[model samples]
Each structure stands twice: as structure tokens, then as C-alpha cells.
Target: MHIPELYCPIPSSVVVKDPEAGEELIRWGADQGFFSLDSDAANLVRAIDIPLWTALAHPMLKSADDRSFLNRWWTWGAVFEMRFDTNAGQELDGFFEKFMDSTARTQIRILSNNPPLRDGEDFSEPMDRTLVSLLRETEQRFGNPWRSRISRSLLASAESGVWEARANYLSQTPDFDLYQGLRRHSYGQTYITDCAMMAMGIDAEAKFLRHPVIEHIQYLVALYGGFVNDLNSLDRDLYANNRCSSVIAYRHQYGVTLDEAIRAVVDMCNGYLRSVLAIEAAMPDYGKYSFDDQEADQIDSFFYILKMLMRGNIDWYEVSPRYNGGWKPGGPIDPAPWG
Candidate 1:
């Protein structure tokens, strides 16, 4: 396999994860049908090691034995399968779209302090009912805007999945601009970012989220995540004849070989990260918006967590058995160190 090195400035952390929490996640996911309780869960654990990856990628999850966070991570798999799994086909495409839309409305009403208009309308399936529990847990901690923000991110992702599915059916390849806008949600990084912000006590209001610097950082974080995923999962996507990948698109555009395409994608990830660095360099100590001492600390934590998320994501991809450890199949390239 050809595993091209990705360059980044943030160092990887060596934090250990809670095995008990990981096991509990497997059990819960089984009950939800995200995986079977036995071999399927074991294989998923081996391939994705999602618990470790979750702990690694989210700074707040590190050293925190919160099962709610772990459950939320497990629950997203169900959402991913429902929303983007190709085998789920147009059936889930429509079903999840309608379900998620209703879910959004429910979340809104809850935040607005309005009662549900009726019963059994919230969740049509047990698989999806977990989301309600997770939402309530989130509300108990971070109310209103954070919960609404979470709903928006999840809805944005569901909506993007519809577009992506249509593009796949039509054999259309998305340009960088179009993909950049949707990839943040379609790839589910925006939801992850939202949860991170909520956990860190950052304001989830649009004013701060849409602040130019913060927006750019969030976009780059998504881009970094998307590009790295494309780099590692190129093998799987290629096998599925999926052309919605930056590496594949670059290859087709330039008529380059797969190895060359992979290398170019690595450069793309580096560019995204360097842009994030530049945003940090230009921003004030409190970032795009300023506030009191406590708020300043929260904002600083946001930046710090952003850096950790970027670094930990790459680190997880590097070590995970998933997507063949993020390598393209060709056996032993230089494995040369990248910047």
C-alpha cells in the first residue's frame, strides 16, 4: 500500500482511553443495530477503534469518562448509516431526510419550550429514538442555542447527504467550492465541531460561529478532516467507484496516477492546516470576538481544542485499521517524512 505522509504542526497526544467505556459503547451500539454484539462489534472496534479515535479527536473526551459523549459518538454511526450508506439507497435517503427534518422540528420545539404536538411522531424507529435521549442529555447540560446548533449541524448533514446521493446517482463530481460548503456537514465535522464548542462553554450563537476567523478555522478543520479522510479512504471509495473524493477528482483533472493523486491530496491537507495557522496568527488573543476574562479563557480553549482536533484526527487516521490505515494499495512507497 502507498501511504503518503501528511504534514501538520500540531503534535499528537499519548492519552490512554477507558476500556470500560469502550465496551459499554459496543453494547449500546449492538442494541441500536449499529453493529452486532459479538463479532461485528469486535471487527468494528478493530477497524475503527472509534472509542480511542473519539477520545483522541475530541479534547474534552480525553480523560473524561462521560458515557453520554461516547453514546453520542455511537449514535452518530446510526445517523451516518441512515443518511449516507449507499446500500441504504434512496429508501433511506428519503426516509432519513423526512425523519431528520421532523427531528429538527422536535428539537426546535423542545428548545422553544413548546410541547410536542403529538406522540410517536418524534421517532418512527427504535434505532432513531436514541437521538432523543442524547438530545435531552445535551439539554440538561448546554441548553437552548447549543442544542439548536447541534440540531442545525445534524440537519445540515442530512440535507447534504441528499445532494451527495443525487450526485452519485447522476455520476456528477463536485467542484472544490461546492464540496467545501457541503463537506463540512456531509462529512459530519461540523456536528463534531459544534459538540466541541458546546462542551467548552463557547457561545453557540451565530455571531461567534459566523465570525470570519472562526468560520475560516471551522472550514479548514472540516477541509482538513475531509481531505485526510479522502486520502485514507481512497482505496474504499475507488473500489465503490465513488468519484466524490478530492484525491480522485484531482487525479481525473490532472490525469495523474493514484500515487501522484494521493500525494497531491496530502499537499491539499497541508494547505488547509497552514491556512488555519495563518488565521490564528492574525486573530487577537480573544479571537474574532472579545469578552471578559472567563469568556477569553473559553475562546482560547476553543483555539487550543481546534488544534488538538486537527492533530488528533491525523494521528487517529495514521493508526486506525480502517481504510487500511489510510493508505492506498500499492505496497511500500518512500514513506518519506512530510513537513
Candidate 2:
């Protein structure tokens, strides 16, 4: 399972303050099968004391559905771990429950709809029963949380927007420019809201959303994360016929080889990283926003956490089965070390 070339070593600057936290994180990953790697999966586990990562464990343990919990954590927990503190994590756990419940309600509502049929054709047949059966099974497997009708509508609308964005991209012809492609590709749920919550912890929504600089930070972080993914997912995306890649877009626009396209992407990512770092350095003294002392400190912590997150993406990419030659159906895609 090892790929020396794919490996992105953890930097000393992006560190975990507590050894126990690091061990628990690694253990949790193993228990959850976060990667298709064996016990000696340290390379797959990057150490960043993201308090939010720790916070999720409590809810996860209490969850009736381990798979659903694992899916959520496996998807975002790796990235979240790099930047958040303990209090931030706790705050996020509360938000995570709300967000997941909202998402589930949205999903349920979508599934509840009847599929459009041709004129003069009734869908009240065996398939309709089958669909209802499937829906019931899904509901039973994953219990629904109480969500207000207004909350459901809002979440559904948000989900619809993402669906529209993706559909719009797929409907378009190829040969999109880098910006267009990045916007389309990077526009999915990247937990930008949750990231901001790291600073505010509780009641963080209004402050983070209202702040002018936050949008810029969000855009940069999304682009940075998106580019990192586009770079790592070159092969998988190509194989899966997902061509909305920034690197591929660059190649189409410039007529370069894949390697050259990769280099170009790497350079762009590094540039974004530098920009974020510069922002981190300058944010403290900027004094434009009416940030209270606590808010200011949180913002500073966020920037630092962001750096680790961006870098940790590179590290996680190297080891995640999702990127490595590890994903396969109906089997342990990669064998454990003992085997």
C-alpha cells in the first residue's frame, strides 16, 4: 500500500500539542477503517490537535449508526483535525448534529418525491412498492432527527443549489478555463462554515458570516483545498470520467503534457498557500474588522489551523485509499500488514 512518491511528510510546524490526542486520533482512524492501511499506519495519520476532531468522538460513540457516523468523520475529520482547538471541536459537535440532521431531512424529502413518468403511464406498480420499501429500510437503518419544516426547506434549497452547480458543469462543453473549472469543481460542501466555527466556538454563525475578510479566506482555502485534490485525483478523476479538473483545464488551455499540467497546478497551489500565509501574518494588525480581543485571537488561531489543514491535505492524500491505488468493490482493497 506504500507509495513513496505519493507521501507528504508531516511538517514539525504543523504539530499536535498532546501525544495522547495523537494516539487517540490514530486509534480512532484504525477502528473506523479510515484508510485501507494496516496498524502501522502512522504515515496516513497526520498530527494536528484539532479540538473538533476530539469533540466528534462523543457523538460518534453514541450514534446508533456507526457507518453513517464513520462516513461523515472519514470525509471531513482528517482535514478538521489540523486546525481546531478543544473548545472549537466541542462547539462544532453541536453544529455537526444540527447540520447532519438538516442534511438527512433534505435527503428524506428528496427521496419522498415520486419520479416523473411519461404521459398516460401510471407509476403505481411493483417498482413503487420497491422504492417505498427501500425508503423505509433507509429510514430504519438511519434514524431521523427532528428538524423544523423551515430548517428542512432551507437545507433542501442549499442542497438544490449544489445539485444545480454540478449539473450546470456537466451540461457544459469541455475546454473550460481554469477559473470556471475551479469554481465548478470547488463549489461543493467543504465545511467552510465549520472551519470558521473553530474561532467563535459558540454562537459563531453571525460573526463569521458577517466578517468581510472571512469570504476571502473561505475562497482561498476552498481553492487551495480544491487544487490539492485536483492534483492528487488526476488519475482517479481521469479514470472515473470526471474531467472537471483544474489541471486538465490548464492543459486544454495551454496544450501541455500531464506532467507539465501537474507542475502548473503545484505552482498555483503553492502560490495560494503563500497568499494564505501572508494573510495570516497581516491579519492581526489589519484592524479593519471590529473583532473583539477573543475574536481576534480566534481568527489568528484559524489562520494557523488553516495552514496545517492545507498541508495535511497533502499528507492525507498520500495515504488515503480514496486517492492511492486502494479503492475496490467487495473486498479489503488492500490487505493489512499482518496478512
> Whose lDDT is greatest here?
1
Model 1: CA > 4 A from native: 1-3, 33-35, 39-42, 62-68, 87-122, 253-257, 285-294, 324-339
C-alpha lDDT (0 to 100) for residue 273 of candidate 1: 86
Superposed by TM-score, candidate 2 places the C-alpha of residue 279 at a distance from the truth, in angstroms, of 0.7
CA RMSD of all predictions: 6.1, 13.4
Model 1 lDDT tens row, 1-339: 485677787877877766676567667676765557665334444446667677777656533645357445545543343344442223433553574466544533543435643454565544446666666667777786777777677667656766765665456777756765677777567777777667766877635556676777887887788777777766666655665777777777778888887887788788888888776676675453544444556656778778888888888876666544433333221110100
Candidate 1 lDDT trough over 10 residues, lowest sum:
330-339
Q: What is candidate 2's TM-score against the reference?
A: 0.51
Reference-based TM-score of each model: 0.78, 0.51
Give the alpha-carbon lDDT of every model. 0.63, 0.43
Model 2 per-residue lDDT tens digits across residues 42-110? 333432223333232122132234323333333333322211111121244344346335533333343
Count clashing residue pairs in model 2: 2
